[model samples]
Target chain A: MSTARANRMTPYLFLAPAGIVLAVALFYPICYMIYASFLDWNPSQRIGEADFIGLRNYTKLFSDAAFRESMWVTIKFSMVVVTIEMILGVGLALLLDRNIRGMSVLRTLFILPMMIAPIVVGLMWRYMYHPTVGIFNRTLTDWGFDPIPWLADGDWAFASVVIADVWQWTPFIFILSLAALQSLPASAIEASKIDGATGWQQIIYIKLPLMLPVLIVTLLLRLIDSFKVLEVILVMTNGGPGLSTEILSLRINRTASEFRELGEAAAMSNLLLIVLLILTFTMFIYNKAQDARMARLRKVEEEV
Target chain B: MSDKTYDRQNPAFYALLIALVVMAIGPIYLMLATSLKLNVDIMSDSSSLLFMPTLRNYETALCDFLWYEPEHLRRCDPTFGRALVNSLVIGLVSTAITLVIGTMAAYALVRFRFMGRDVVSLWTLMMRMVPPAVLLVPVFGIWTFQFGIDGSRGGIVLVYVALNLPFVIWILQSFIVQVPIQLEEAARMDGAGPFQVFFLVVLPLIKPGIAAASIFTFRVAWNEFLLANALADRNSRTVPVTIVNSLTEFDIDWGVIMATGMLLAIPPIIFTFVASRQIITGMTAGAVKG
Candidate 1:
């Protein structure tokens, strides 16, 4: 074979393993889930034996109160966690965007929570939130205050789980936002300072607007991740306190394993998949738009 | 002149930075403090800033039996030690496989102009975005029925590779592209074949990139919980699953659980500290440059 042709063929050859795995493992399962969602699948029956109920699963999902509640819970959880995490993460980033001694060490330690396994995080917080003997309530009692029902009441349970999630994941946004903050046009911020802009004003007008693109992508990424969170909540609450904290992934998990409704669980997963698909599509488009704009600016520079 | 003036007048900046640092690290300090205390101390004197440290929790974690032996299954048993070993083995092996394959794919994408390259790039990016829970059921079915690799370390390894390959490929591709093509061309013109050029000329240039990608892949596999939890039965449970399983509604043992948490955290913590500079720079550059 010619060298050039051989070179052309090498990439395809190298891509073969990843391509096959993605097809079988990722694409295949998604297709399977889509097909399974169309069936009235029960754990007792084989998939082939299950009745083919086209769109019925989707239709039933729209009116199902439990499904609706779970969806609402997921939406609320994602919004609340992402909102608080973004604020704290960015606030922390803005405050810590500096070159002080030991800053790097502190930044590394800050992101340690994100590196721990979600299940481990869930366990860690559960110990800290233990009702009678957990550090939180114990501290409260030590302070001569009543021990609050952290994981018992519905609202408290939801808030507690959210707190655990925010604790673990806020570092994600912090790192990304810090990167964005550091990469902002340094000259622009300096000019804003010379223009008599205070620190807060410089942040609002100069740094944040410049960091908007990264912030949007980070927010969308966190949103998609939060929607699919299961392990932490599973380990912490097991979707307990009367299902008050049962987000969609946890609900889907229980439906498959606990309720033994494999087909319905598959259908619910597809619904979650669609929601994620929309978010992913939005992110993809946003990325493409940003790239195209950058390319256009490059072309303009070249022409000039 | 601007630098000196700014440095002298940044008192508020220093104060804000100190406050941010404290807030960021406060929880971890709490976790470390809590981990060092006795269970009774943790429960009783939670507000006290100082305490007599105890190594009893670590001792108990190392020498404890939190297993259930079914009457029929006399010979088989599970322990935290086995799970920790399994997690380390699986994580290392999967990361090795991912780095080799992903580096090759990344090199091809960077150096070779071929059909479907753009599509492949887009697909890999999309793969990173796929939620793991969405694939839990189907993956379980695939492993059990189709591949017959269910509940094995090998099965978990395959899943980790499939899940982490995109990240590996994406990061390595950027790193590989930064390597000048002319160097490979020079090696080829000097009688080196493509493979020889890649091995001798190109690989050495991108070691930092490969290191960065390898650490990330290892971290992902090590810290992954859901797929391991779903795929691995008692025989092949991972560290995260074992630690999580320690918690029960009845008769919880906080000491052992904290000890295991400390153990589970040590590897990643050590890796991070050792490669803190490289990993942080790689991640920050990957985000902005991409």
Candidate 2:
């Protein structure tokens, strides 16, 4: 009788530990964040002591030009970084999706950037971007060209941050695109070849069409991740020379730590979360729609 | 044309490949070279290539762990070494705990039909969207005020486990879905209990998933800076926190900091080399789900 009961309870038993941990650690903190967003809180004050000032944090953020600039910067950074990385990554994927020797070695090397800590990645780039004793400036000097202000100026600082991110993340998209290309239906390409299709034409038509689903998914994932990028930019520019390079995450960090306004940071976090949630929902809907389209196509083909 | 034989490409193509390889690893190579060089050599305007490479910077970073006192070091700062230990402990312990419970939860989600599974799955998806910066405030508040676990390695571990759980469970779900339900049935028929079936049957089959999940979990715990910085006091600081702290100083020690950065980068690079296939599979499976 006890054994029967245990068997019935097994799944719940397996799940209970994770459930408890997630509730205490993950779920509760998020609920705390939502509540904290409404309160005039500080790091020095306990939650019980913090006054509840509903919606002021959100309204103030909208009025704050600095916050607005950071928001725009975040959006611009995500869009520009994702666009450049996608083009470069996917283009390279197409160019090198061949039975070449050392492909495995190349991939292993490519993943190194993505694998390493973002703080360390930022440090390396910061070192390279240093005006004196830095590799880039040193090289420029060696070539008898004036050393460019990589991180000292506003526009250059933003561009430097973007370059570092592109260097680190492009391989991620490349590897994924290559995987999608490899797993593509060989027969579709073979048929295209039999019709005397040029390499570019085959890629433009069948290959691109087949890889579209993965590409879309990859693009959305990268876009979502680009918003979360904090450390690399933090290390590279620290949002310096002005507010030009201050993305939302960096601004939130400053608000909470430097400014000592936990409520404002929480409000900023809430907005960022909402933006991410919208993007995530878009991906989910896209996936659902694609599923429906695939099902409909299968049904149509069956009737034919 | 043969599938088995490597495809031959143009000379120009090989040149392009070499250039791409060089470009991809260029910054990393620069880091490694800088780490091995002295400050004098690094600051030199003369040819950067030919220089006496020394491990003095590495020695400085790992001074606390050295068996004999390093003579070059006037005095040793124990921060980096302590942080290295903290990072390892937090990363490994959190990863182990996460994998155990996360894999079990994933197994239940895949193999058993239950009311709670939907809730669990929903939390996993939602949690992935929340960034670390977003958590910095609430987690700091909760840990410091509510739980009072701040300034301990355990606090950082808890956050990491929670932070990593969603991805781990999600990745493991796909792998668990592929596990043959028949194997569990056969084991059940042989009088293996539910716990035994999971541990003896299902878990072993999902080794690849475990490998991938563990790598990711450990990587996050190891590499994370923001929350760890906020939560950790001086005693519990991780390597990233230390690296960032050092960077904020007015006069930067390029060679030493680069050496520290190189040390922080070594484990992930090692993982990539050892299990590139698993890491790639995990990346695609977790993201593309196809």
Predictions in order: lDDT: 0.79, 0.91
**Model 1: clashing residue pairs?**
none
Clashes of each: 0, 0
Tens-digit lDDT string for candidate 1 (A196-219)? 999889889888988988988889
Evaluate model 2: give its TM-score: 0.98
Any runs in candidate 1 off by more than 4 Å, and if so which?
Answer: A1-6, A42-46, A302-304, B1-23, B33-38, B45-52, B64-78, B116-118
Off by over 4 Å in 2: A300-304, B1-3, B115-122
Candidate 2 CAPRI assessment class: medium
* Chain B TM-score against the true chain B, candidate 1: 0.88
Which residue pairs in candidate 2 collide? none
Residues B40-120 of candidate 2: C-alpha lDDT, one tens digit per residue:
998888988899989999999999999998888999999999999999999999999999999998888878877565465
Candidate with best DockQ: 2
- Residue A260, candidate 2: Cα error in Å is 0.5
